[model samples]
Target: MKIELLAPTSAALPTLVVAAGERASVRFLEFFASAIRNPHTRRAYARAAGDFLAWCAGAGASSITAVQPLHVASWVELQTQTHSAPTVKQRLAAIRHLFDWLVTGQIVPHNPAASVRGPSHTTNKGKTPVLDATEARQLLDSIDVSTPIGLRDRALIALMVFSFARIGAALAMRGEDVYVQQRRLWVRLREKGGKTHAMPCHHTLEAYLHAYLEGTGIADDPRGPLFRTVARGTGQLSDTPLPQANAYAMVRRRAFVAGIGTKIGNHTFRATGITAYLKNGGTLENAAAMANHASTRTTQLYDRRRDEISLDEVERILV
Candidate 1:
């Protein structure tokens, strides 16, 4: 039995009226608000908690009090087998936090997830996949820039490779983010954790962007999306902005057409950009700042130094 509560626009707040049977439950709404800071994180945690609650209902543990450590351990085991280590860890953490709130609120005698351990982090090394410069060039060359859609794809690929943008940030970009001063192109990007970073556009990227803009007839609207869907069927530019999923699909399609049998995605361009920059004598700190990583350790994962070892230099040592 569920009840819905509605609040008037002029009212300061909604009223909560719990029935006699549901009196012993924890304040789920309050707990949810306090547990989550960001909307994205809140959604993820809510989904995880929903899954656990559904499992608990099926297992005949309808209330938080009926939950036990064995149930949590079994759930963790199921998640470990089905999902990646990081995902399992996140879900487990969410469950642990939920039960902690219940215990603190005195709704439950003990926290079931307290004794449960998440998936092991045995292979915690970051093994990000990336494309080499040759493959990247091949991808760019594969696109025919004579057509509007092709020119757009070329510019998008160039931005991804040169700017090292996450697919979300790239898709979120608006036309006004690009600024031209003294014939030099620059882009202002809003990155993760709500941080903004400015980057100069490379000459190759600038040329591609100019061609794309000219071919697409994009307006100078700062509020409009930078990348839009090219209406190949109608021979016009789409008003809608490209979503993150579309960006991934575009990369995959390009990789297929280029005949580059690599698992290339948006992150591939970022990893490739960072690795290429480091190989060309760029410092880890610069890469970290560009990548919007909080720590050098995160950026170092993309810097594959082992591939840079020179066998000729080692063999030619006279000492």
Candidate 2:
């Protein structure tokens, strides 16, 4: 399977030469290039795999073939000390997956990381900070929509909240993705694994999207990016899609201006919307479908409705 690849050094898998040898290095590159499709996951796994092999080199493990279960276990143990359980688990998974691919390619005799267990972790809730219904409204209303950038920001945030979209999926939108169907504005999101999800816009979302498109005058450019970065010093939307880091900065800036004390980020709106839906007589099953969650258990993580109930009961302690 020939795949386009960066040099091992460029891929952050620099130690492949010293630890994996020249022949084994090609297989290592293939592991990341072909096995992982998601860019975020590919970058993360590359970093994790690179860190592990670099550690192996420092410990005087001569080659990738020389790495054993003991080395893998020791590295994982050290990770658990400095990292969260989920992070350590993901790092361990990266190593195990890389080794599994190497073993299949005959570069390694066995998967050393397969025998090393990762840190244990379990949680019913996600850690993504969520705003309540009131805070969400305040933030949305606070945007100064006289400018094109303001309109874009409001629309992007509203898209995430209303559609329960992942930030990557929301930013991946093209102009044509937002369109009219059945006399209502509907959004088409190309979600993870390239799944196309379509949903009718919430009434508020319809207004925001319409205002953004009409105000920016980019509605006619259907093939262009739906959301774009403002040109430096020009205050006009550029052809480039907004980067996720820039979006995070924009969220922080907007939240500070709106007097919202809760630390929120791009994902906050998705959880906020899910919680609000569940509070208003929505079923968990339906919430899961709306959020495009593969399972209700995943959707449960975003449900913060129980948090309000707990707070209300706590307030009943009249001292």
TM-score of each prediction: 0.80, 0.95
Give lDDT tens digits, candidate 1, residues 1-319: 1212232121211111122124333245445566666666777776787687667667767465777898889888888878999899999998898778867777678888998988777542356677889999999999988877788788888887888777778777888887887769987788876888888898898889888777777645668888888666885668789877887898899999999998878788888888888889999899988888899888877775555466556877987
Instruction: Report model 2's TM-score to 2 decimal places.
Output: 0.95
TM-score of 1: 0.80
Score residue 290 of candidate 2 by CA lDDT: 88
Please list all clashing residue pairs in model 1, or write none if there are none.
none
Model 1 stretches with alpha carbons more than 4 Å out: 1-43, 100-111, 122-127, 181-183, 305-319
* Model 2 bad stretches (over 4 Å): 1-4, 7-13, 16-20
The 10-residue segment with the lowest total lDDT in model 2: 1-10
The local distance difference test score of each candidate is 0.76, 0.89
Name the top lDDT candidate.
Answer: 2
lDDT of 2 at 314: 100
